[model samples]
Target: MSATLKWMWVLAVALATGCGKGATPLPTRLVPTRMPTIAPSPTSTEPGSADSGWVVAARGIEVRNLAVAGVVPDTAAPIYAVRLDPALVRLRVRYAPDTPQLLRTWVAAHHPLVAINGGFFTADNQATALIVADGEAHGASYAGFGGMLAASADGRVWIQALREEPYDPAVRLDQAIQSFPMLVYPGGVVAEISDNGQRARRTAVAMDRAGRLLIIVCPTSAFSLQALATWLASSDLEIDRALNFDGGSSSGLFVDVGDVRWQIDSFTTLPSVLLIEPRTS
Candidate 1:
């Protein structure tokens, strides 16, 4: 089938499976017209320094080999941010139902530069929300969750709250992944906090003002959902929109840049993984 017709078929399936329902409306906040200025790149004359951001806090560390940088924001949590250029990287989803894979396993198999755990799932390792992998829809659009990360055919990334709008498969998207409880909207922080307010390790996907993809992971068990949102909104990362993924024990990030391999493995295996691979011309 032609690529256009294939997307149309997926849209039909998504609509038939009750794509639009039970949507929690996002708060009507004014989106900022001007983009925030990103900090200058790290000032090290090192090889991977071009991809690194300035060290923010005293505890900040630079994994020069992996092109990853860590910062301790005032929120008291360590956030590792890796910037991936859209022109150089291709984003896609990888899933294995019968045999779920770890972040490292997915990296080794696909040989992506970076990989992170995808959206929430059930005990059977099935994704909870709508998922489009390589122009194919794997599940129906779920309205219960509020946020979605979509990659266009041109490799551009867009993050939005599904509560505000449902996923329209008619749009040209190579990969569309959904998650819950949006961390930061376009204007500012607006995450739905739980009554318990327990702190745990958190993972999030965000787009910076410079149109770069940021895969953030908080390895510390000191940030609650509300706290994490506040930190992200106030940080220097200049994040436009952020989505919270299945965190806690499901939080993980793996990067294999050059000969250096850096990984934060999850306690349990994940059902899906979002990978950033080199774009082949």
Candidate 2:
């Protein structure tokens, strides 16, 4: 039998034997007669090419522009592209305004279920938003529980906000959850780990699947959902929804291009996880 055919059979059996949740599809391997090799270029220097601050680890993919940039006061603007790993598909900003109120207004005007209220909250088609949609909890809030897990038009992303208490991993809510760790959004949220191996709870602007914008502003910082929205709309790259995480000393960005990777910013401490930027083509 041909070598290619032999490898195909092996992969087929591997997949056939494994049929359960959270199992990503595997690529069929192929046998080759010749081994691939690349001779080191004479120009290659010794070690320590990169400085002490940043590190480069990803390759092949393209590195686009920075996600955040200065923008006009209040308008829907373009920022940068945030690549969703494993899927090369890019989420461009459909249309986003600045500030929580303006962004909320923009969402309400365009979205089917969006609305505005005292808090300037707005929902997309899913009918979420604490204060936007009618009968929604105007004063809804969350405490201690950190991380931007999921965002839907329903209450899957949010639950009854509680008073600050000790961290609770067993705390449950009635929403489907999706987690993107080490990602930094517009406002200030940084989904990372604390110095003590606990979940880092920061808030910021994040984009949903539909490219809608959402903001999470904590009591700390000069965060004004409305002001941030205004600033974001002025960015050169497009944005959808931008949600905030947490911020303070735990803020940084990492970039990598093949064997060339480094940090864009430095933090006094390492975060639990980091949003890695693979080589952008």
On TM-score, the leading prediction is: 1
Stretches > 4 Å off in candidate 1: 1-76, 258-260
Q: Candidate 1 on 1-281: residue-level lDDT in tens?
A: 99557545543332222111121212212111111212223423232234344332111122222222232233333455666667777888876656777666777788877778887665567676778888887766756446888888887788878777777767877897887678888766556655244555667888878776778876545556676787778777788878887765566777655433446776567778898777875
Q: Write the per-residue lDDT of candidate 2 for residues 1-281, one digit (tens) a residue.
A: 89557534533332222111122322222111111111122212212122122111222122232212222223222111223322322111121112322222333334311111111111221111122222222222233332233323332232111222322334443222221122333333332322222112123444544443333322112223344444444433243334332232222233223443322221122212222222233
lDDT of model 1, residue 61: 21
Task: State every prediction's TM-score relative to the real structure.
Answer: 0.72, 0.30
Q: Candidate 2 at 5: error in angstroms?
A: 66
Q: Report the C-alpha displacement of residue 233, candidate 2, in angstroms.
A: 3.8
Candidate-wise lDDT, in order = 0.62, 0.26
256 Cα displacement, candidate 1 (Å): 1.6
Q: What are the per-model C-alpha RMSD values against the true structure?
A: 11.8, 21.3
